[model samples]
Target: MKSLQKLATIALAIILMGSCTAQEEATTLKDALKDYFYIGTALNVPQVAGQDPQAIEIVKTHFNSVVAENCMKMMYLQPEEGVFFWDEADAFIEFAEANDMQVIGHTLVWHSQAPRWMFVDENGDQVSRERLIERMKTHVQTVVERYKGRVHGWDVVNETILDDGSWRQSPWVRIIGPEFVQMAFEFAHEIDPDVELYYNDYSVSRPEKRDGIYNMVKDLIDNGVKIDAVGLQGHLSMDFPTVEMKEEALQKLASLGVKVMVTEMDITVLPWPSRRHSAEVSLNYEISDEYNPYPNGLSEESYTALMDKYVDFFEMFMRNKDIISRVTVWGVDDNQSWRNNWPIRGRTDYPLLFDRDYQPKSAVTRIIELANAKKQ
Candidate 1:
C-alpha cells in the first residue's frame, strides 16, 4: 500500500512539471517572438502611471515596445506655443526605462491633433509658409531633441496622403506646400540623426493609398530626404484588405529601400459604419443595431473568425519580417480599444487578441504556434 502511494505521488509530480514547462515556453507575446521582431501596444496615461494594474502587467508581459497613445502628441505636449508639458511624457520615458522597454514617439507632425495656435495668428488668419515652417521646426526640434536616443523612432509626418492617391490638403499643405513632410523629417534628423524617422499613414492596403505612399516615399528618397521607414497603420477590419493586397503593399513599401513597420494595428471584428474602412476620426455614424451587432459579445463563430484573421495577419507579418522592424497593436485589449466608440458610438467590439476580461483569446496561442511552426 505504501509503495502504491509513492508511485501515484511521483506520477502527479511529473504531470505538474510538464505543465510548468509548457507554460514557461509560451507565456507571453514578447517572449514568443523576441527573436523575430518587436511586439508592442500603445500606452495611455493610466498605464504609464501604473494606475491600471492589469494593463501594466499586460504591457510588461506581452510587449517589449510601446507608443504613447496621446500624451506625446502636439496638442498634449505643447498646448500653447512655448509651454511644453513634460510631466506625462517624462513619466512615460521613466516607466519605459525602468522596465527596459523601447519607446516610440507617436508623431512630430500630423494634420489631426495639431494645435490651432501653430496654424493661425492671434487675428485668426492662417500663418504664412515661413511662419508655419518656423513653428514646425520649433515643435519638432524641442520634442525630438528632448528624447534623443531614448525613443526608437518618431512618426515624423502622419496621414499626409489621402485614400484617392492625392494630398489631403491639410493646413501644412496649404501653408507650407508639400515640402512640410520633408521638413518634418529633416528637423527630426537634425536633432537626432540616429533615430528612425517614419511617415505613418492608414489605409495602405487600398491600392490608391498604397500607390500614393509608394510614390511619395520614392520621391522623398529621390530628393535626398533623411526618411528612414514607412509606418502602415494596420487598422484592419474583417473581410477587408485581403492577404494578397497586403503582400503587394508590403513589397511595394519595402521596394523604397526603407524599412516597413505595421504600426497601430488592431483587427475590428465588428461591422463597419459604412463600407469605407478608414481611421479618420471625423467619420461618424449614428448608433444602430445594424452597426453594433455584437453588443452582448462576439458569437462563437465570430470569435473563431477573428482568431483566424489574426493568424493570417501574423503570418503575413512574419513573411515580411526581414523588412519589418516592429509590429504594434493599437491598444492592450478590448476594453481600452478606441474602437469602442469609433465611427459608431456605444458599441462593444472585440477587435484585439485579448477579451474584455483580460484573458488572452485563442489567437495568442495560435500566433505563437504559427511562429514556432515556421521556425521548426
Candidate 2:
C-alpha cells in the first residue's frame, strides 16, 4: 500500500505536468520539488483573469500553488466600508481551482492596505475597541466563509511586529490592542475551522525580532489559538540576512511546533536604499543612476552574482523543507515584480526565477537540478 501510494503521487504529478508532444516532458519547478514542498508563484489580476498568457503558462506548468498579490488585500476587496468587491478575489480562487493548484489566501488581516474606514467612524472619530473588533469579525467572516475549504492557508496577520521586537503600534494596536492579532486569527478560524492560520512578518530573521515573534506566538499557542504556521517573509536582497541568519530562524520558528513557510520569497539584485532592510509599503525614493544602476540591463557579473545568491537560498530552503510547507516566489517574473518600482520608483530588479521574457533563469535550472539530484 505504501508503494502504491508513492506511485499515485507521481501519477498525479504527471497529469498536472500535462503533455509535451514534440519533446519529452519538460522539467518543472513543482515536479522537482514535489517530494519536498509546494513550489508557488504570486498572480496579479491580469494572470488571475486569464489576461497574461505568459504568466498563466508559467503558473500552469511550473507552479502547483498560487497567492493573489493584490486583489485579495483589504483595500482592493473592500475599498469602502460595508461594500466588498469579489470579482478579482473570486477569479483568483477560480483560477487556482481550474488549474488543480493549491491556493494560499494572501492575507485576511494587515495594517497596510487596510481601508481607512475600518478604524474610524463616520464622524471621523477613532472607533472603540469593541466597535473595531466587530468590524474585523464581519470582514473576516464574510471573506473567509466565502472561500472556506478552498484555500490551504491565509496570512491571518501581517507585519505587526517591529524589527526591535516591539509591536508596530499600528492603528489596530492603538485601538484594538495586541489581542487584535489573536482576534483576527479567531475570526478566521471561526469561519473555517479547517483552514490553516499564519502570522507573517518581514525582518523576522533578526534575533531581536525573532525572539519577539517567538514570545508572541508562544502566548497565542498557550492560550489555545489555532495558529498553524509562521510565515517568514523572505523578501531578501543580494547581501542582507546571511544564510546562517535564516537557518537559525528556520529552526527557531519550527521549535514552536507549527510548520514554517517561506512566504513572499524574492531576492532583489538592485542596489540597497536607505530603508534597506524593511519591506514597508511607504518606503519610496527618488531615482538616480546610483540606485538604478541596472536600468539598461544586468551585467554578466551582476547576473551571475544574483544566480549564486538564489542558489544559496534555494539550497537552504531545500535543506529545511521538512518544516517548510511552501516556498513561493513573490511574482511570476522580472517584468511583473513590484521590486521594479519599490524603494525607488524606476529601478530595474531581477528577483524571481524567471526573467522579463518569461524564460526561466539559469538559477532556476540550477535549483531544479539540485532538487532532482537530491531526490535521486
Candidate 3:
C-alpha cells in the first residue's frame, strides 16, 4: 500500500509539471506584440455569441482586439429604413467590453451586403440623389451614435477604389457621387470625434489601387475630412503582393500622416483562380478536386511553405511597426477562415495562426520569438 501511494504521488506531480509547461509554451500573441501593435481577429456569429468554447478561449488567450465578421454590416444592423436590429451587435460589443478588447465597427458604407431598398423606391426605380444622401446620413449617424465611445474604430467606407484607380461604381457613388465617402466619414466623426475612422479595402498593394487610395486620402485630408487610418485588408496569398509591394504601399499610406492597419489578414494556401482581381464577394467556382489539393491534409512540405510565408509577412510587419497600428487575423483559427468557402466552396484551407483543434501552429511560436527578440 505504501509503494502504490508513492507511485500515485509521482504521477500527479508529473502531470502538474506537464500542464505548467504547456501553458508556458502557449505564449499569448497579444502579449508578444503588446509593444508593437494590437493583435486582433474577426469574430464570427459563433464566436461573438460565445457558442464556440475553443474559439473563445483562443480569442481571450491570444488577441486584444475584435471585429464582427458579418453581424455589424449594414444588412444585419439596419435591414430596413428606420428599423435597426441591435441584438447581435449589442452582444458583440458586450463581449468585447467583458474581455477588455478593443472593438472596431466593420463598415458604415459598402457596395455589398447593403440592403437594396436603400437604392430603390417602392416602384423599383433608383432613388433621387437628395433622398439617397439623406438616407445615407441617417444610417451613418444612427449607427455611429449608438456605439459612439464603445467602438474604438470604424471602417467608414470599404472597397471603394478599384484596381484601375477608379472609384468602383457602387450605388452610393452612382446616386450621391464620390462625395458619399466623404459624407460618411464626416457623419461618423460628428458622432464620435474620438474614435478612429478608417477606409478599409482589399487589393491595396496593387500599384494602381494604392495610388488611388493615396490620392483619395490626401484629398480627404485636404478637404478637412477627418480620416484617421487606412485599413489594408490583408487577404493575401503565398505568391502575390511581394514584401516590397506591401512595404511600399504601407510607407506611402503612412506618409499621408494616417495610421495603417493590416485588417483581415490571412493567407490562402489553395491555388488561385483566374479572375483573382474580381472583388465580388458573391463570386464562386464550381466544385473541383484539383482546387482542393490538400483535402486529406497538408503534407509536411505544404505546411512548411505556409509557415514560411507567414514568417515573411510578420518580419515585414515588424520592420514597418512604426506605421502599422494593428494586425488583425481574419479569424481565430483555420476552421473558421473564410478561405475554405471562398472562390471555391467545400475546400479545406489552413490560413491562420491556430489550427482546427485550437492549437497554436508552429508559426505562432516563431512570431512570438520574433516579437520577443525585437523587444530585447
Candidate 4:
C-alpha cells in the first residue's frame, strides 16, 4: 500500500508539470503580434515616466513593429520651435531597436495635435502659403533628419480628407493650401530615401472616405510623391461598419499598389449615435442610452459587446491578410482607451483586447484563435 501511494504521488507530479509547461507556452499578445501579423499599442512618455520596461516586454513578447511618438513630427517631437524633445523618444527608439522591433513614425504634418505655433503667424493669424510650406519643410527635415534610418516609416500626412470626400477646412489648407500633404511627403523622402511614407486617416470603412483616400493617393503617386502606403485608422464600433465595406476598401487600395494598414483600431461598445438622428436628439431607447450613459459610463452589456465586436474585426482581419500590413490597437487596455472621452464623454469604455487590470480578455483569446486557425 505504501509503494502504491508513492507511485500515485509521482504520477500527480508529472501531470502538474505538464500543465505548467502548457501555460508557459500559451501564446501571449506579443506572440500573436509577431506570428500571424503585426500588433502594436501606443505609449505615453509622461504616463510611463519614461521607464516603460513593460512596453518593451510587450513588444518583445508579441510585436515585431510599433508606431512611435507622434514622434518625428511637430507636436510631441518639437513642441516648441526648434526645441526638440528627444529624451522620451530617444529611449523608446533605442528600446525598440535593441529589442528587434520596428518603429513607425506617426506623422510629419497633420491638422490636429500639431504645435499651435506651426500654422499661426506672429499675429496669430494663418501664415502665408509660401511661409507655411517652408515651415512644413523645415519641420519635416528637422524631424526626419534626426531619426532618418532609425524609424522604419512615417505618416507623412494625416486626416486630410473628410468622411464625405471633401477636404477638411483645417488651418493647414488656409495657410499651406493643398500643397501641405504633397510637400510633407517630399520633405520626408529628401531626408531618408529608404524610409516609406504613408498617408493616414480614420473612417476608411465608409465608402465616400475610402474612395476619397484612394483618389488622393492615386494623385500623389502620379505626381511623384513617393507615397508608399495608406493607413486605415480602423476605429470601429459595436455594429455599424459592415465587414464587406472593410474588405472592399483593402482591395481598392491594394489595386493602387499601396499597402494598407489597420492603424488605431479600437471598437467602442458605446452605441455609435445614429447618424440618422442628430447629436441633439436625446437617447430615447434604454439600450442605447445605457450603452452610452451620458454622465456615468458604459453598462456591463456594453462592455461585453465591445469585446465581441473586436473579435469580429480580428476574424475579418484574419481572412484579409494579403492587403493588411500592420494592425495597431491605439491603446493597450481599457483604462487607456480614448473612447472614455471625446465621443461618449464621461463614459467608462472597454475597447481593447486587454481589460483594465491588464489581464487578457476573451477578445485576446479570440484574436489568438483566429490567428492560429490554420494551425488547428
Deviation in angstroms for 14 in model 1?
A: 19
The predictions' CA RMSDs to the true structure, in order, are: 4.8, 6.6, 7.0, 6.3
Question: Which prediction has the highest lDDT against the true structure?
Answer: 3
lDDT of each: 0.88, 0.88, 0.90, 0.73
Question: For model 1, what is the error of residue 333's alpha carbon versus the real structure, in angstroms, after optimal superposition?
Answer: 1.0
Model 2 shows how many backbone clashes? Answer: 0
Model 1, which residues run further than 4 Å from truth?
1-24
lDDT over C-alpha atoms for residue 209 of model 3: 94
TM-score of structure candidate 4:
0.83
lDDT of 2 by residue, 230-253 (tens): 989889987788888988988898
- Per-residue error (Å), model 2, residue 195: 0.6
How many residue pairs clash in all the candidates, one count each? 0, 0, 0, 3
lDDT of 4 by residue, 1-376 (tens): 9999999999999999978865655376556545456777665554335454554455456566776534445688878877878877776677678767778888788877789888778998877888878888888898888887898888888888877887877888876677777888888898899998899887777788889888888988899889887888877766657677777888898899888888887776665645631111123432344655533544668666776677777777766777777888787667666667645455667777666666677777777756655434
- Judged by TM-score relative to the true structure, which candidate is superior, 3 or 4? 3
The sequence of per-residue lDDT tens digits that candidate 3 reaches over residues 1-376 is 9999999999999999978865664367898888788999999887777689999999999999999999999999999888999999999999999999999999898989998799998799999999888888899999999998899999999998998899988898998999999999998898888999999998889999999999999999999999989999888887877888888999999999999999999888888776565435777888688889998779899899989889889889988899999999999988888889998889999989999899998999999988877765
Clashing pairs in 3: none
What residue runs in model 2 are displaced by over 4 Å at the alpha carbon? 1-26
